[model samples]
Target: MKKILVVCTSGLGTSLAMRLSIERFIRERNLKVKVEHADMGSANFIEADLIIGAKQVISCLSKQNDIETIGLEDIVRRRYIEEQLLNCDTIQTWLKEKEGLR
Candidate 1:
């Protein structure tokens, strides 16, 4: 399955919120993927298809282009997750494959 990393300042409260939001989106869309959370300072590195986080967290992980990164204004909103991820190729392809089911 595809993997998504949701990052935040400390990867605790705020990041947890984002992870939950993304999880809901994944469930609602019936997408086959996994979502995870990490802290900007402690994430070290990530192994996933996409990384979603605030500007700060994204900046920290920007050096690694191997993993795609999406910046978010707010970490706990489905709208933000949808807006940022909709145009992503990973999401696009996944959605295309699942479109018939929906």
Candidate 2:
């Protein structure tokens, strides 16, 4: 499985919301990915193959870590989140490699 970290401003509300939404998305699609939620302050401590977040983690906290990131302009909308995620070639490639590893 792959690790996906979802960062939010408060690290609780929006993060939790996105976690739930992404969990449903991953489950319904049968994707072998593990998603975790946290605040940007704790981003450096969280290790993930892909870091998914709004502006904070992408533009701000990104410099703290060397991990690849996916920025979300609208975290509340599931459509935009799914669209952004679907368009990420990094995640796609990782998924393929993970499948191969299996």
Best by TM-score: 1
- State in Å the error of residue 98, model 2: 6.5
RMSD (Å) of each candidate, 1 decimal: 2.2, 2.3
**What are the Cα lDDT values of the candidates?**
0.80, 0.79
TM-score of each: 0.83, 0.82
Model 1: C-alpha RMSD to truth?
2.2
Q: Flag clash pairs in model 1.
A: none
Q: After superposition, how far is residue 72 of candidate 2 from its true place, in Å?
A: 0.9
What tens-digit string does per-residue lDDT give for candidate 2 at 1-102?
578888887688888998887888777767888999998889778778777888655788746445678888888898888888778876678657767877
Off by over 4 Å in 2: 64-66, 97-102
Cα shift from native, residue 23, model 2 (Å)? 1.3
Looking at model 2, residue 93 earns an lDDT score of 82
Query: What's the TM for model 1?
Result: 0.83
**What lDDT tens digits, residue by residue, belong to model 1 across residues 12-100?**
88778888888888898888899988888656576788888887678866566566678887666679778778877778878998886
